[model samples]
Target: MQLRLPTSIPEVQECLADGAVPIGGATLVWAAWQRDGFPELAVSLRELPEANTIGAEELGAAVVLHQIDDRVPEVLHRAAAGVGTGAVRRAATVGGNLVGSTLRCLLPAAVVLDARAVVLEPEGHFETDLSDVLAKHHLLVGLRWSAPIISGYRKLDAEAGGPPPFVVASALHADDGGNRLRVAVRDGYEVLSGTVACAEDSADVLDTLHRTDLGTLDPTAWETVRRHVTELLTRSVGG
Candidate 1:
């Protein structure tokens, strides 16, 4: 019912301490409010400059989805490209996408990239894994991660441009003599993740992926998806 616009991170934190729900773009918040009732105190982070900026180390939470598609890593860009329509993408914030939704395209991509979220708590700001932050109801301020050597994302959808029932993202990083391949799958409410060493056998990587316990998908269907994802990763790694 009540709205407060904060211009700085400290002000945003103070508002949060006062029990205000942080809002960015308000696409998700407005939808929830329309379905249910509005919260007692709502804080708008739009006025904060840092919340809207994208930098080398961190991406501001309030940065719009389209900007992320343009400026972030290729995996995140691919994920953002699959989000909503152009209008919705223009209005949706990165933080909102990360925090408001459960089966989102970006979360799995972020997971494969080993992204970390910088959150604002009542105590102070702290950096934590993106998966951990998603598990808890934390106030996310920014996201941080180092770019990988190669990354790819694919979503298997029933309809064109619609949200897919299953989404997969893979990232490869040079580790000693071999490469470390990380794959993550987002299937409805369940997230399945696995890592394997891509040294001599690529089939071994696929086998490790099949071994992941994706609770939402059946074994047969998961095998099919795993094959497709392995092909995608192989092409991305140019191997």
Candidate 2:
């Protein structure tokens, strides 16, 4: 196998043009390789500065999970902190987490944050919504978004230290007369999102959430999750 380390965007693009598979952190990629055999040529993005830095409004795809947990918004930090363990966080990159799997915590948070992804296409770099980027295969370069007024993330696992069965993220923004609430839920397979005017009471907010489709959740646990999400939103908005 040939390993190419590209320190610049142009160099990385050249490598991609040569049919080299891109790797960031390689946590998931290396595991996949071990199970399904390694690729002939792989491009390592660790050397690219833009792929590892945290900008004012953007996070490089290669930024480590722990860095995000430590530096980014609390919503993103909560998502990052649930990624696995301390060692896993050290080796997992935000880009890898997003593009590697649809079942990750960060994607839901990104959706609620109205994050856009910078994708490197054959023509040139362009911006797309995180949801759209996830739907289609794209070379993700980084993520960008304006900070919201307040945000929160919650993950529910079947058991302690196990993969989360459900993950939810909520963000609130002050509007003309009231507040706007945005919520995104990832229930194992797909992500569902909805937005509504923030309600004054937690019960009213919970009712609105129930009316807003949150994808397929177990009926037995739906109420439980709804209450949890309502509490999270309430605490975040100080309501």
| lDDT (Cα, tens digit) per residue for candidate 2, span 5-33 | 88877887888888988777787778779
TM-score of each prediction: 0.85, 0.86
What is each predicted model's overall lDDT from 0 to 1? 0.76, 0.77
Off by over 4 Å in 2: 160-163, 236-239
> Which stretches of model 1 miss by more than 4 angstroms?
55-57, 159-164, 214-220, 227-229, 236-239
What lDDT, from 0 to 1, does candidate 1 have? 0.76
Model 1 lDDT tens row, 1-239: 78998887778888988999878778777877889988999887777776776753468888888887546666788888888789988998888888986555588888887788888876788899786777896888888887777777777666664645677788876778867877788876677887777755667677666666543467765775667566766675575
| Candidate 2: residue 107 lDDT (0-100) | 85
**Model 2, global lDDT:** 0.77
User: Superposing all C-alpha atoms, what RMSD in Å does each candidate have to the true structure?
Assistant: 2.9, 2.6
The residue pairs in collision within model 2 are: none
